[model samples]
Target: MILSCIKRVSCGRIRPVLTRFLRASTAKHHDLESYLQFLQTQANVATESTYYKGLLYEYTVQHALKKLIGISPLTRCGGTGDNGIDLMGSWNIQKAKKKLDSLTILVQCKASKTKTGARLFREMEGVHSYHVSKSRQEGRTLLIVAAPSAITKQGFAQFQTTDVPILYCQINRVQPIYDTKQDTFRIDNFEHYSVVQGLLANHAAQALLEKCDLSTAKINVLMKGNSVEHKKASPPVVQKITLT
Candidate 1:
């Protein structure tokens, strides 16, 4: 069955031989090439599938962020050896708690089918640690993990004591996150509102401030029901030196 699916050739004849050969359990290496090919093809398909899911969610998350924070498009960086970092962008504001323009927005999006748990963030944690270590030597950076699926209560608790923010936002349209009818991205969690609000303040100008205010207010209205007790997250070190 596997070989028939992988090859466009007729397996009607080889199917019987493959079945009989399998039942016999004979050690015939000459005919193993087809099986090896099947294995490699399956492996490749699986790899591509996983990468595609990650990339799709990364892009959707970046789009949602722009609509949420009134920022330009962010870079999608999810791929092999990406250090679990998915989206990278810059957040500009008049003034931030750490005296930076939200230097760089580093996002890791987990598109898991199951409820997001602490285990899902293991790789991203390493990425965050690397940045936190070098933050003092560089501008401020806001590292965020966005799990579109429901994050179990335990998942939220895991990051409560850490500096990284766990955003319970969806990355695709099927998540039923908010107004799934349209391609709109609304943040449904309020735990980190202050952190996000500070980024969206945009006090640099009256027009930008109002725009951000409106966006944030809209989000607040949409997420009020899901809002929970707030937690003051540790100050993130970030600056708007430049983001490529």
Candidate 2:
């Protein structure tokens, strides 16, 4: 009986160590996967930045289009491939009764890093003129120039004078890079986390109106089951979207 008791005690002592070893192994694998995913995302963004640098002119134009009203390459433009504007995308805005209305935009990407001058503005105006001449009313036409570097204040002022809105994406202002060590992202000087979270919020509100997935943040808020319906239906989707 004494031997039996000793054996049971030994087994009990060994169980926790064995269980801890298994848990440590599982945790190590999970951490490694998370780290690898972070690295992959950073690498992809960096490669894109390098490629943009190589084609400095085109990058500026694309950047301008994206910054203005959050139009991305992924958005549907619903336009033709005429004139200088090559890409298109759209964003859904929220309205009363939580409805989503999409605004489509046409982009003209110009790869020109040269210093800004009257001639550059004229060239952009000419592109806009040509775009209008194509007789397409699918979406608003935007003349964009992606410069290799920055545009002078004088050049920006020149664009401001006209009813014709010319979008200029300066190279330095919109440099997107992902740093793995910092676990952070940036577009030029702008941080990614705040911007991403804002987008997620907007997306959530729009989607819920469209009967899509509720914003994760919103779900969390609702899950808490707080009865503070104080601010109408502002929906926490926007905040959740920003965190992404």
Candidate 3:
């Protein structure tokens, strides 16, 4: 009947919204120190710069990437650049594939206190459309989303549907970061989408390989889904494990 059809149509639209709300609400979002709070206490810095917080978080995440995933020589391209890619680096795909291979990685970091929405993902899609996803002659390209606060359930769903392999790095802190310098409060925690966890299962099993997940961004991945948690290494403990 027409009534039943109307109900179905409405349900279809409402379900996703409801789901996103419920899931995002379930995620444990801690009280984070805002940029205003950080700038007010600081002596001299561009308080008008809205990107200050975002850029600071980028630097912090970049350092974490270096230690965890070995993203060396990372290029910082933030601010007015239309490209959604904030940081660029080389990622090793050896573990994902048999032979050794590297891909150019584009990273976009979203450190908003609340869950990131689909708008960010849309921008990422614009940066590298299906064309890049298909592996170009110049070289393969991989997109990495670095969200310290984590992405919303609805936004994550969009990522899941993408054919392109996206390395979703959920980098966060238990306490509010007050320091202006990226060095002060070291980020020790990270979370992953289910698909990322599955792809890095073997590596996760190995205490040595598990902690660093950013280096495996590759194509033809099944995108099979776990939440892989990682902690930063201590000063002395870090000297032992050799990166491959």
List model 1 lDDT by residue over 1-244, tens digit each.
1111111111112111111111111132111222222333343534346654554455456555664454343655444445556665566644334333434556777767677566765554566666444434132444556654555666545544444433334333222133346534333322233222222211222223243343334444433322333333332221111111
Question: Tens-digit lDDT track for model 2 on 1-244?
Answer: 0111011111122111111111112222222223234445444544355333433323334443344334454211112323344444443444344422543333444334456555666665665555443343212333444443444556555555544444443333334465668765433333221222121212212333244233435433542333243333232232321000
**Against the hidden true structure, what lDDT does model 3 obtain?**
0.43
Which residue pairs overlap in candidate 1's backbone? Answer: 103-239, 140-237, 140-238, 141-237, 141-238
Per residue, candidate 3 scores C-alpha lDDT tens digits across 32-103 of 123224435567876335455665566655655554555555645454422455665665544552332555
Can you give the TM-score per candidate against the true fold? 0.48, 0.38, 0.51
- Two-way lDDT contest, 1 vs 3, winner: 3
**How many pairs collide in each candidate, listed in order?**
5, 18, 3
Report lDDT (CA) for all predictions: 0.41, 0.36, 0.43
- Candidate 3: stretches off by over 4 Å: 1-43, 46-49, 93-97, 130-139, 173-244
- Of the two candidates 2 and 3, the one with more favorable TM-score, higher being better, is 3
- Residue pairs with clashing backbones, model 3: 194-225, 194-226, 195-225
Candidate 3 residue 114 Cα shift, in angstroms, is 2.5
Q: List candidate 1 segments past 4 Å from native.
A: 1-48, 94-98, 137-139, 165-168, 174-244
